[model samples]
Target: MVGTALGLSLVLLFLSVPVFLVFGLGSGLVAIFGLNLPWSTLIQVSFGAVTKHVLLAIPLFIFAGLIMLRAGVARRLVALAMAMVGHWPGGLGVAMVLTMGFFAAFCGSILAAITAVGSIMLPEMKKSGYPPAFSVVLAASAGLLEALIPPSNAAIIFSSLTNVPVSQTFSAGILPGLVLMVLLIVVVMIRGRAFSRNERAGWGARLVAVRRAVPSLLTPVIILGGIYAGLLTPSESAAVAVVWAAFVGFFIHRELTFEGVWSALKATAVTTTVIFSIIAMATFLAVVLTYTQAPQHLTAYLLQYGIGPITFLIMVGVICLVLGTFIEIVPVFYLTVPIFMGIALTMDVSMLHLYVVFTAFAGIGLLTPPVCVGIYTAASVANISADKAFPQVPLFVGVGVIYGVLMIFTPWLAEWLPSALH
Candidate 1:
C-alpha cells in the first residue's frame, strides 16, 4: 500500500500536478485500494496541520519579507553590500552573496531573498560586466541562505514538527550558514577575477550608502538579537519584524504606501495560502502513513536488512536531495519530515540533531537540478539559463553536505542555542 501510494505520488509529481493534488490523489488511492480507512481522517489532519500556533510564523515571515521588499529595503541592502564588497575581486558577485545572506537572515525565505535582492542585484551585475551565468549562479546559490538564517520559517516549521527548540535550530544553523557563505564567496572570487573591472565609487559615497541602509541592515540584529537576549519569543520577534518592516517602508523609506501595503498583503496572502495548503495536504498524508503503520513497516524492513541508523540517515538525505531537484523546499519539508521523523525517533536520534540534518539536506535541494527554484529564480532575474547556473551547484552542495555531516557527528551545534535558551 505504501509502495503504491509512493509510486502514484511520484508519477503525479512528474506529470506536473501540484504537490497538494498529488498527495490528495495518493491518499484517495490508499483509501480505495490499499486500506479501508475512514475518509474523514484526511480532512481532520489537513485542518489540524494549519491550525497549529507555530504555523502562524509562516505567513508573518512571508508578510515581513514582502514588506521589506516593497519598502525598498532590498535596494538599500544591495547598495550597502556593493559599497562594502563591490571593490573586491568579483566584487559584484560578492555583493550579491552578502546581500542575499543579509536578507535571508531577516526574511528566512529563499524566494523572498531571490525575488527581492536578486531582482535588483542580478541586473546590476550584468550591467557591470559580470558574466550573466555567474551572476545568475551567484544569486541562486546565495538565495539558499534564506532558509539557513534565523527567523527562518523553515527552521521554525522543522523545530515545531520535531518538537525541538526553535531557538536551538536557529543557532545551530549559524556557523553552518556562515561556512556555506564563505565557500560560495571563495568560488565566486576564483571565477570572478576574469570579470573584475574598475568601479568609480569613492569611500565617501560608500559610506553614504551604508548610512542609508543602516535601518534595513539592523533588521536581523533586531530579530535574532532580541531572541537571543531573551527579550522576546520567536513569535514575538517575528511580530516585531513585521511592524518594523512596515514602519521602515512607510515612514523612513517612504516606499510602502497604502497601495504598496495592499499589494504586499495580496502577494503575502497568495504565497501563504499555497504554503499552508501544502502543509494541510502533507498532514493528511502523514496521518494516513502513520495510521497504516507504514513508517513502522518501512523502519523494520530497513533495520531487518541491516541498514544502520547512520546509513538510514544518509539514505534519507540522498532521497531528499533527489526530491529537491523536482520540488520546492516548503512542500518537500511538509511531505518528507513527517515520514522521516518517525524513523529518527525509532533510531533514538535527538530531535534537534534530526532537525538540523534534515534542514541541511533541504538546503542542498535548493541548489539541485531541474526544479531548483532558487536557481530558476536567479536565472530569470539575471537573464541566464538554468543550465548555465549548474556549475555553481558543486560549491553550494559541497558546503551543505560538509556542514550536514559535521552536525550529524557533533550534535552540540544543533543543541547549544536551545539549551542556552532553556
Candidate 2:
C-alpha cells in the first residue's frame, strides 16, 4: 500500500497536478484499492481536519490584513519605518525588513505580509534605485517572519497537532522571530548601497509620522497584549483584530469604504478556501500514512543507524527545504510532523525546540523556488517574475539554514520564554 501510494503521488506530482489533488487522490487510491478502507473514512477525516474552532484565527487574521491594506495601513507603517530608518545606508531595504516584521505580527500569514508590505515598499525601493529582483527577494524573505511571530497559523496548527499549549507555542516564536528580523536587516545592509534619497526626517516629521501611524500601530498591541495577558485566546484575539481593524480603518482613518470591506471579505473567503482544501487533503494523506505505520517504520530505520539529535535535526531540515520548494507549508507540516514528532519524542527531544526548528526551516522553504509562495506573491505585487527574483534567494536561504542550526544547539531559544511565562 505504502509503495503504491508513494509511486502514484510522485507520478501525479511530476505530471503537474496540483499538490492538494495529488495527495488526496494518491491517498484515496491506496485507501480504496490497496488497503480496502471505506471511502467514508476519508470523508470523515477531511471534514474533521478543518473543524477546529481555533482554526478560525486563520481567516480572521487574513481578513484583518486585507482590511488594513484597503485602509492604507501599510502606507502608514511604511512611512513610520522610513522615518526611523530611511536616512541610513540601504535604509529603504532596512525599512522593508522592519515594516514586514511589524506586519507579520498582526497577520501571521507570510503571503499577506509580503503582499501588503511589498506593494508599498518594493516600489519605493525601486524608485530609490534598488534592483527590482533584489527588492522582491528582500520583501519576500522578510515576510517569512510571519511564520515565526505570534498569531501564526503554522504555530497554531502545530499546537493543535502536537498537544502543546497554543500560548507557549506563540511565545516560543518571539525570540527567533527577532533574530530573523535582525539577520535580514544585516543582510540588506551588506548586500546593498544607500538607496533612499530622502534625507533624515526632522523630529517634527518623525512625530507627524508617528501620529499618522498610531491607529495602525495599535493592531499588534491589541492582538499581542490580549493574548499574552490571558485576556483572550488566539482565536478570540483574531476576532478582536477583525473588529478593531474595521473600526479603525473605516471610522478613525476614514480610508476604508463599504466597497473595500466587501472586497476584503471576498479575498478572505478565497484565501480561507485554499488553505482549508490543502489541510483536508493532507489530513487524508496523514491518515493513510498513520495506518500504514510509515512513521513507525521510518523511526526504526533512523534509530537503527544510531542517529543522534543534531544529525536527526539536519535530516529534518534537508527534507523540509526540499519539500518546501514544491509544496505549501500546510501539506509539508501534515506530511512530516507525524513522522518526526514520534522520532523526537523517543529521543527525549524538547517538543518546543523541535517544533521551533521545524517551523523555521518551513519559513525558509517559503523563500525557496518553484513553490515559494512568499517570493511569488511579492513578485506579483511588484509585477515581476520568479526568474527575476531567483538570484537573490540563495543568500536569504543560507541565513535560514544558519538559524536552524542555532535552534538545534541552543534549545533555550525556543524554550526560555515559555518557561518564564509559566
Highest TM-score: which candidate?
A: 2
After superposition on all C-alphas, the RMSD of every candidate to the true structure, in Å, is 2.4, 1.6
What is each predicted model's overall lDDT from 0 to 1?
Answer: 0.78, 0.84
lDDT of 2 by residue, 301-359 (tens): 98999999888988888888788787777777877887799999988887888888888
Residue pairs clashing, model 2 = 90-194
Could you estimate the TM-score for every candidate? 0.91, 0.96
List, residue by residue over 371-408, the lDDT tens digit for candidate 1: 77777887777766788878767866776777667656
Report the C-alpha displacement of residue 82, candidate 1, in angstroms: 1.6
List candidate 2 segments past 4 Å from native.
194-197
lDDT score, candidate 2: 0.84
lDDT of 2 at 211: 99
TM-score of 2: 0.96
